[model samples]
Target chain A: MTGRTRRPPTGAAVLQPHITSAITEAVLDELAERGYGRLSMEGVARRAGVGKSALYRRWPCKQDMVLAVLSQMSVPLAEFPDTGSLRGDLIAGLGAVHDWLTHPRFVLILPDLTAEAARNPALAEAIQATIGTPRRQLASAALHRAVERGELPAGLNLELALDLIAAPIHWRLNVRRAPIEPGYLEALADHLMRALGATERH
Target chain B: MTGRTRRPPTGAAVLQPHITSAITEAVLDELAERGYGRLSMEGVARRAGVGKSALYRRWPCKQDMVLAVLSQMSVPLAEFPDTGSLRGDLIAGLGAVHDWLTHPRFVLILPDLTAEAARNPALAEAIQATIGTPRRQLASAALHRAVERGELPAGLNLELALDLIAAPIHWRLNVRRAPIEPGYLEALADHLMRALGATERH
Candidate 1:
């Protein structure tokens, strides 16, 4: 279906928002079909009904396109509402992670991209710069808030704590492909609070 | 280096152990070079200096060959000596996981194989059946020993506990590409015991 011929976008359709969204969607479709190892700008352009120049103007390389699309998709999803308690915030935050990992497009895209990143150092750097660092910062904001509110130890290892919050869910949903039973997030939050030495407000 | 032509093995070198080890090593080399997506039986045969029949005799397809090689490499590495206490056993077990993820061959092989497994259901099943199940069983045996020693609650959720042990290290070392500082494992073991509600033995 992605290989079907289509008329190129008109001059007016070359607007940044229009063409950028089309290209991003096309990249996701291509990744789902071809996986990241085989994804090409040519393929995305064809799939988006745009010319190669349109893609090249936007992102000079596949890594750029992939990272741009991924960051756009994931960064906003990383934000967790201030739920007033570390327990509440963690449960809310991990629930968002649960939804994202179980989402159909992400389920297909992440493993392939992660695999490609392992082999390509430039892409790895791009991913960390664009996706990994920003997302972790957003997640860490919650812990910073918790520390300010006297809910956690000031000396908490924020880096390790962030990994603790996200990794088990990822390992279960992505690696083990297991179901997250109802109330799992609450239990996980409790375990995490204990692991990080969080104290509840009186 | 893997692309260099080699003289075919002599009739004497076709002995089972010799040919099997050569093919298995070639699979790791090919996986590290070409990754699982592009690896092929022909490449393995060429890399191993064996006839294609030598490969077909062992595996019906590329996935089979890959899973076979990975199983051989990982299952033995999964063995962790029982260190008597749950804390000691966990530290020892997670250390093995840390080592395997950092090992050069596995560092290259794991992500590619994981990505391939995400796309191919049969390969996923083969991986889970061969590598995942056996490795988890070995890890679980340590927990079973701990439970017998009365070091953990009888109601411990073995699956979640296992995920807790492995996920942070994987996320840190593989996903985030961060360094595991010295003494980190000991601290991680301490945190894990608390997270799992272990009753420490004085």
Candidate 2:
């Protein structure tokens, strides 16, 4: 065994990051073009200009690859701005959601992934853990700040309040495919504040 | 040629409704199991225990077939109750939505079809025309009644209100997969009423 000379790991080491990035981009493109149902490791590898072995090395299957890519894209976009008031904070937060959904990549990717997640429980779990929970937490933090400032009632239903903050915009843009008019977010924020019993402190 | 006796269209004519019903059920099952991307006329026909010609006789393609089936299922379910009060009407309307979504077939079919509609513009249009429009009309009627009864402001934003009524339940059940509590709908209705400026007349 000592007589056999081992090849150096230099080439594989050098190509790893590049290969990973290429595969990630390719997976997203494939998801955008063909959707999750039609996406395959072979197609992703071909699109990435890498061998299938490289893809298998990174992800065991298409679902894992998709989850990883979505997590990478979504988590970074979950930033919630701490505007001075609850109303300001909500408008800013929802505006971010609007921008994210309307972005070219997500416009194509979200619907497909949502549909896939419906049929695939494992993917749904990954989505909630990676994308859904973090986004809700950030929005919840905004509401918590409002409660602390006495802008909202102390016993406000936080879960329902979070749903209110995000659901309308999602339904309009994604479900109804309707356009959001200018000044919509501010109006929405006003309505949400009223719904949550937010009022000026005396 | 005219002398040849007509077969009286006995077998197919007699079996038309049964065959149509069978194919419709098959399409829903196929959508639930494989989703829209993988659904095919051939598979639907096979599942229905009918020939491709039979399916072709009814609809031109898969899109038309799916749309027809969904329309049949959705239109009947769009009935909204006149509960006399804005809050009551909203709870009733949203309760219907909740029931429809949680129904066995819809639970399986809606997510996949929604996902498919996102990718396919033509399908989206068909869905909006068939399923979306009627449901909105019914819900809107309830709100209009509230306005007439002076429950809500006359100049309230009906479009936004409509989105508010339906979006949260969907986000919870479908997007978040969270369970609604026993009194959740009533509580939600209260919040929505406040948000939409619905209050008792002077």
Candidate 3:
């Protein structure tokens, strides 16, 4: 694999705010190894080889730190594989969701982010910037495709259909706490298609 | 509204395990008041009006102490509503979910609990016990009811069906990190009924 080479060094490293990205990756590894509750600023600082003061200067605390970790883990909705059909687009979109959220690191990190968001609006904004944008975009895309194809009737409340497809999958992982599997994707797709007035012939 | 009346205490004031329960409740309240990142055991003990020694005698560290706080908030699955008919019953089950999980205290508390659980098995187990049991009971009840009602195809995979209804919902709150609204409940109930090869017609 080719790696990007940087230009010759300038006066001082700008720190580009990307140092947190690398440090956060190390923190995620530390989390997988040590677990979220057990993770510490001292431990992450040591593991990332950055001074704890540098870490705190940016994060202020672990909640902000953890949200940064989660921000990177979210997949963008625009990344959906497009092949020109609503059925094709949806299966790919839901399938991507299946792959992204079910990972162990995500499951662990997200709850902390949500908890932090409940108290800290700044951290919540970061979370929204990274994760929520993608989630909403995907839903909007699917609904737009349906309307364009005349599959969904005019004035058919697209947001509600979006909720139908996504909300069930989310409910399972968060409240019901069940395993994500292939059958679930199929079921959700099947139900959502019918609700959107799309036929299963695809 | 009737209130629970407390009986007069017996003469001797001996230490008991209930103090652990009381302390855990206090910590949970503090967690809601102040975000988990700001949570400190000394603060907890101060709020609990207990000596630090008393708190330390129980859990070895902050992780274990928070784990105790989470463990108490869990509700038993035995309360899964048994109202007749799959749609009615599932809605009731969902309502039970809303009552415990979406309740003001729990909505904030759960994200922290889940974050803690994702990295810790014992904590995951404790969280899952509160989460999984109810879904299992609801799914099992629905499957059995369907079979008895001749609504489901014979020899259907009840477990997969359960996961279908379940996993999506789980991610909605924890991953998408949104609240479950009334319309969400209705769509889920309607979709689950039809997907399992039953009638959505009331």
- The best candidate by lDDT is 1
What is candidate 1's lDDT per residue for A41-64, written digit by digit as tens?
Answer: 889999999999998887778888
lDDT of each: 0.84, 0.83, 0.64
DockQ of each: 0.54, 0.57, 0.29
lDDT of 1 by residue, B1-202 (tens): 2567567677544446788999989999999998887888899999999999999988888888888888888888778788888988888898998987887788878877777777777887788899888988999999888888888888887877888888999888767777898877887887788787889677
lDDT of 3 by residue, B1-61 (tens): 1377555488754445667767887788877777455688899888888888878888788
Candidates' RMSD to native = 6.2, 6.0, 6.5
Which candidate has the highest TM-score of all?
A: 1
Off by over 4 Å in 2: A1-20, A50-62, A200-202, B1-16, B51-57, B200-202
lDDT of 2 by residue, B53-77 (tens): 9988888898889988988887767
Error of 2 at B124 (Å): 0.8
- Can you tell me the CAPRI class of model 3? acceptable
**TM-score against native, each model:** 0.89, 0.87, 0.67
Ten contiguous residues with the weakest lDDT in model 2 chain A: A8-17
| Chain B TM-score, all predictions listed | 0.90, 0.88, 0.66
Could you tell me which residue pairs clash in candidate 1?
Answer: none
